[model samples]
Target: MTGDTVEAVSCTQLAYAFGETRAVDGLDLSVREGEVFGLLGPNGAGKTTAIRCITTLLPVPSGMVRVFGHDTARDRMAVRRLLGYVPQQLSADSGLTGRENVALFARVFDVARRERAARVAQALAAVGLTDAADRLAGTYSGGMVRRLELAQALVSAPRLLILDEPTIGLDPIARTGVWEHINAVRAATGMTVLVTTHYMDEADQYCDRVALMARGRIHSLGTPAELRQGLGERRRAAGTGATDTLPTLEDVFRDVAGSGLDDQSGDFRDVRSTRRTAKRVG
Candidate 1:
């Protein structure tokens, strides 16, 4: 997966603006072939907007984005052929069975009928959904729905996979299950993954590298260890004399992107606060 293959994704000074607001601002990023690259950010931090531009779902308002060595703007079809996207929103039709949803994606991806059935079956098995393949997605658990979405993405066996908030709205156990499947897919196929996640633990554990974005711009980019090291240096430079230990990714997140977590916001904020408090008490 790493020999002479081209970069899975490349972006230089990418920017997107909506009215008076800059949704994504001057972001530069690169994902190596077969690597799991996490885009970590809180809500409204332009992670989704950057993904949209890279996957060709949304036009790039400025700068350049390339997929598999093809310019996103000049070679739309070539880019689409090399990539698969699972949006943050639920896209499966509630009325359709899990298998049916995968089949639908196969068709949309222009997979031949002779190959679609086998491809769909393989994708379902990869995501551990073969047992529930015939069940309606509406009846599946939140975790199952997310896995089904992943199966859809794998139907085409794309070289690059883009996922936005892939594990949102799931219990910890369920989220772990999703991460396991994601890693399994990467191991089996050597597919490049670009994921947006607010879960600091997930990024720290699974990503080979991460780009931290805030308020539509990237504030930092490096491996989790590198980012933590940088944060340690900053803390020392600030003369806090808090040489207890280097901060975790969550601490770095709060330090770089101001904490906006509040009870009313959503489960994410609640989870973040709970984890922070537990860390302090521990």
Candidate 2:
């Protein structure tokens, strides 16, 4: 792709403060168009904080973030129009039917009144929720609820789909199902997917490229294969045995990001920790 075709997401020296706590520090990243990219890190690595900034959920300095060339701070609405985000929390209202939940997002996205119904239907089908679309979301299993959320995100026809720990609480089979639908959608739309997950294996399997962030900085960025190969090359150069099993993404992550993970919730729940850190900063 030409440089003229804008990146799906870019951050240059991006930083954020939660009171005195620096959540994101001098971060630099670029996610190319039509690729499933991941910000893989454990909790408190500033992955969510960065996602929030990119999605314009939290304010950031102007020019620090851009979506498809539109400054997140300067062109908030325009950036919002290009992305769909699913958080770690449950989004599908249990009381509502699956279709209703997705329809609500369709309306929120302002899918033309004439197109909303069809769009909602299409999204539900995309996620394999057609058979259960009429059932109350509460009746569906955890995996189904996540799929419902995926459908809601898809209803908008977003160019970028941002999922924060999309499979956080589901079982292995369910996690696989969620990714299957995600892959199907990306295949059909060539959507640029920017997802965050603490699950290294998931990133290795689904992402075309990944960035390992910890302590608010990206320590590694590359395709999974490239990262594995690069680590092997380094090991060989350093006189390590060449016959060692090929390095996995996990090994690469520990090498670059270290073991400290931000374990706090990174939100109001972290107030106590935030205050403690902020006090230290002061």
Question: Highest TM-score: which candidate?
Answer: 1
- Model 2: lDDT of residue 145: 79
Q: Could you tell me which residue pairs clash in candidate 2? A: 43-262, 44-262
Which pairs of residues collide in candidate 1?
A: none
- The models' CA-based lDDT, in order, is 0.85, 0.84
Model 2: per-residue Cα lDDT at residue 157: 93
How well does candidate 1 score on lDDT at residue 110?
Answer: 78
lDDT of 1 by residue, 72-101 (tens): 999998898887788877787778999999
Question: For residues 154-182, could you state the per-residue lDDT of candidate 2 as single tens digits?
Answer: 89999999998788667899899999999
Instruction: Show where candidate 1 strays beyond 4 Å.
Output: 1-5, 259-282
Listed in order, each prediction's TM-score against the native is 0.89, 0.88
Residue 172 shift from truth in candidate 2, angstroms: 2.2
Q: What are the candidates' C-alpha RMSDs?
A: 5.5, 6.2
